[model samples]
Target chain A: MFKVGITSLCLSVLLVTSINASTSGKLLLSGGVNQVEGSAGGGLTPWAFIGGYGTEDEIGANAFITNVKSSDYNMVSTGFVVGFYNRFEFSFAHQSFDTRDVGATLGLGQGYELKQNVFGAKVRLFGDGILEQGNLFPQISFGLQYKKHEQGRVVKSYGAKDDSGIDFYLNATKVILSESLLMNLTLRATKANQIGIMGFGGDRKNNYELMPEFSIGYLFTRKFIAGFEYRFKPNNLGVATEDDWLDVFGTYAFNKNFALTIAYAYLGNIVLKDKQSSLYTSLQVGF
Target chain B: MFKKYTVCLLLLISCASTDKLSTYHDFGEKKGIEKVVDDLFVYLLKDERTKESFQRLNLDKTKEGLSNFICVTLEGPCKYEGQSMKRAHKGQEITERQFYGMVENMQKAMNKNNIPQRAQNKLLGKLAAMHKDIIGN
Candidate 1:
């Protein structure tokens, strides 16, 4: 499985290198960075923008790698996304969660890693978020993500009802050019526990919970933008409490094909740890 | 939460200084606008996405019209003797991509003309409102 993921990522990189100069449409920083789940968005949540520089007449794709590190845990996520004619988007991501010392305490061995694969699809419903500056309506989209955990039996023994789950979401986004600001709000219905890292549903809840996520950004320049995001989470696992996530981020576009994002994120509590604050970084290369 | 953000945004827009005179001066008034218009055409004609659309245009008339339009948008003392956006772009079949191509060209021109970010945004804010009429009517 790991080998497959690596090979696909390599192919994605090659795709980017070969096609970047030919693909151009969306403005700089308009597509947003690759979120943890591999969608086009902020570091922690998905935004309504499709996933690349593609215009309505063009097809665009990109590959990204992200890392988040805290005191007791580290996470690395890699993915590729394709945007079709700026209307529909398809994405795939592989995530690895390192338990570090906490793995030893749980008898799961030191530096134990949990792996998950996410596949996502999104379709634009209506509205032009960027160009239609005269209107108040935002660009909206509907999306779904299917996630599969590698260690199904291990998570089930810890009270997870399933190791795989689906998440449905609606996103609204607007770019108020007058203020050089961008705003996005996403509503998601999910049954996953800790984003399906530890498992899906648990003893506390088996039904899906609706959560809200928000991102607000100010464009300081055509090449630079800074923002804030908050994502609500569902605590489906009774054994460990889950908390909401928030981050303050800034992304700088080195050019049309390369962008770097850095953020300070608060993941609240994860499993046995509390007040998990960490540094998050991501690099995106696309057309 | 969305409602609160809307209210905040409205407040910010209202509180922003709307001194058009200062903004116009930031662009060095009429002379600066002409320079920007000239540079704008250079970029627009060079960009592959927009070059064909503008290749047949009457360069001098378009430049004068654009300069006048921008001057009036900045609330300067110029009278725009040009056609309305709807009429000007009618039957042109412009795509969203082409529209954005023009926007980027305008940005490049503004940067070259030493226009401040705030002034540029103010100008774009007004022009962006006309996109509905300019794009694929």
Candidate 2:
């Protein structure tokens, strides 16, 4: 109950902050993890993910919808974003996870679904594209993400009942290569309860996990890019776990206005209990 | 490897010959003016201080007005109806340091874009003539 109250208070604060930040500008869509930085589809361009738009002088906004599908389950997520003074961004995302077979195994029912909402904000403390000192390094950004999990069922059988918690993450990202051939790196730490469908159940201790993400891409021509990213995450869900997953992805742009991305991910098993892996797809449009 | 080298060598020779056109005839052609102005634009876009200052200006509109400005200033067939360079830039608080910075940027841009050094120097000579009218120093 105390944890739930704390989560609600934090969410309220995030909402107020987002409302105050709306005057700055809407959030802009970012390229995905395939680009080695943040988002998979539109994240590599300046101010693509960490909010804002480009640098400290422009304002940008973005919206996105993504779907992840596996053999037994599926998840759909949508988000709103805004950037201010080109240095800060505030965002909100709601993710719904559908468990297709929980009813048959547990006698609860079939087609059980759960939802997790994540509220996040990021600030670019330093770096600028206008100050192009070298091609080896470009910009750096810091960000925080807060997530809440809501269970869809009340039978208290499939997993934790009324599972809701918060995870805080700090991330740093940089572009190691530029223009024609680009590369990016990101390191993040989180304290969330559950990673995906399985709620954080073991010991209930705040664990700091290291997530290192990398992406390398080539601009086949001027308006198109083909790239991939490998992201490492901890598989521990309070029980037993295995290795992380590798997201292999690609993207294509139709000009400055529209783009599409497709990715195949291999989610390693956790505790030798269940095997989880899936394919993800996203579409993005911008002005 | 030898064939590639021979091909590169021949390409260099042909390029050098094409660039040897007489200065008098070249100066009057569209290519010459374009070459000079593009070089100048490149330099102006490079300097951090100049770039910051220039971003505040209506460069897209200013660029559109450049043809007329150049035609009249360089004794071409057209007469420039736009404001003089000094008058247009007046009170913008631009200093000699900033002007030179812009010129340096142009130099770098020219080199990066592979514009020949001779063409760059010729364009610089024209810009040098305008310094007195622009900087008032």
Highest lDDT against the true fold, candidate: 1
User: Per-residue lDDT tens digits of candidate 2, residues A157-241?
Assistant: 3333334444333333332211234455666564333343455333434356766656665544333456666656544443445
User: Which residues of candidate 1, in runs, are more than 4 Å off?
Assistant: A1-15, B1-15, B20-22
Chain B alone, candidate 2, TM-score of 0.56
Which regions of candidate 2 deviate over 4 angstroms?
A: A1-49, A52-55, A106-108, A129-135, A152-172, A176-179, A193-196, A201-206, A238-242, A255-257, A270-277, B1-137
Report the number of the highest-DockQ candidate: 1
The interface root mean square deviation of candidate 1 comes to: 1.4
Assess chain B of each prediction and give its TM-score.
Answer: 0.86, 0.56
DockQ of each: 0.57, 0.06
lDDT at residue B78 of model 1 (Cα atoms)? 98
Q: Write the per-residue lDDT of candidate 1 for residues B22-52, one digit (tens) a residue.
A: 8899999999999999999999999998999
User: Candidate 1, after superposition: displacement of residue A91 in Å?
Assistant: 0.8
